[model samples]
Target: MNWLNYSEACARNQAVILAELQPLLATTTRVLEIGSGSGQHAVHFAAALPHLRWQPTDLAAHLPDLGANLLRFGSDNIDPPLALDVTQEPWPAGPVDAIYTANTLHIMGWPQAVALLQGAGRLLEPGGLLCIYGPFRYAGRYTSASNAEFDRWLQQRDPCSAIRDVEAIRDQAHACGFALERDISMPANNQLLVWRKAV
Candidate 1:
């Protein structure tokens, strides 16, 4: 058990995220999680949602720790972690009933964010859900002062990384054949945005 790979943020929010996902994913069979990070959410969610096969993925660089964490605490429903860099490639997984990612969009550059949406559109089955959890700007307005400060910190850390606008993401998702279904408020000024693929 490598405590170093643990994420306090993931620990704090996984239960809340699960509460929203449980009912939405009741009928879903396979879930592909992008940017699985330390695998905390994967292990936790897979354990809670035993019926869904959870596939965790991250960039190659993060795979060692991701895989390690999954192996350490993952259940039978959780698949071995795969290497996925949203900006490129075969995605390394079969088609899934749903896609989930947390706090990933703001960490990726704009091009990468676009790629993720496009890829999610390609990978999910019709009527499948694409659930994204993170802070986002709406109509060019920040939701809170803390989120604004967080956005600034992110930009300072990496100019390419900043909070994305919800409208921009919705537009891209629409172009990719997805329809916005829900925008649920979450803790820490973040939101859980749900989109469903057009059937």
Candidate 2:
């Protein structure tokens, strides 16, 4: 499973993300992780936080690698991966305590990102958390030179793929009844945006 290799960025950033997430997740019983690529982060977080159950989901094509990574880590708190594509008509299951997605938004087109937020709004319980982790543009400007290069690389691979604007994302989230709580700066020019569904 070459695709299952751990990212150096994931290694450097997971602990920081966990620190921010630990408080919000303390009361959460279950979390639905969107785009659980490689599954390294899933297993690591699940093992670290035994109280919160982690449900990993990704495209069907990535499931085998995800499953293998989960098994190799051997954590009971992590559930078997589910096939999930946010742009699809219906989500697999719903009403989770929290939803998390890392480094996925910019990889997908704007329509898919909007659909993902809309789906989260539909699936989250009242006041549930929606945490998105990755680098993003702000007010039509790139945050860093690295992100600019990354954006170029993404667009080169798929013209529809490019770094998103944080303000625009917050606007969409607000429209979906999700209130932005925090925008924590992370390593490697990334950020962790935390939102809560308004009651």
TM-scores of the candidates are 0.98, 0.95
Runs off by more than 4 Å, candidate 2? 1-3
**Model 1 TM-score relative to the real fold:** 0.98
Tens-digit lDDT string for candidate 2 (1-199): 3436667777788888898888889999999999988887787788888998899999899898888888877498888899999988679966698999999999889999999999999999998999999999889899899889999999999998989999889999999999999989987899999999998
Q: After superposition, how far is residue 183 of candidate 2 from its true place, in Å?
A: 0.7
Worst 10 residues of 2 by lDDT: 1-10
C-alpha RMSD (angstroms) for model 1: 0.8
Weakest lDDT window of 10 consecutive positions for candidate 1: 1-10
Tens-place lDDT per residue, model 1, 1-199, is 4644789999999999999999999999999999999899998899999988999999999998888777778899999988898878768897899999999999999999999999999898999999999999989999999999999999999999999999999999999999999999999899999999999
Off by over 4 Å in 1: none
Residue 183's C-alpha lDDT in candidate 1? 96
Query: Candidate 2 — what's its lDDT?
Result: 0.89
| Candidate that would win on TM-score | 1
Best by lDDT: 1
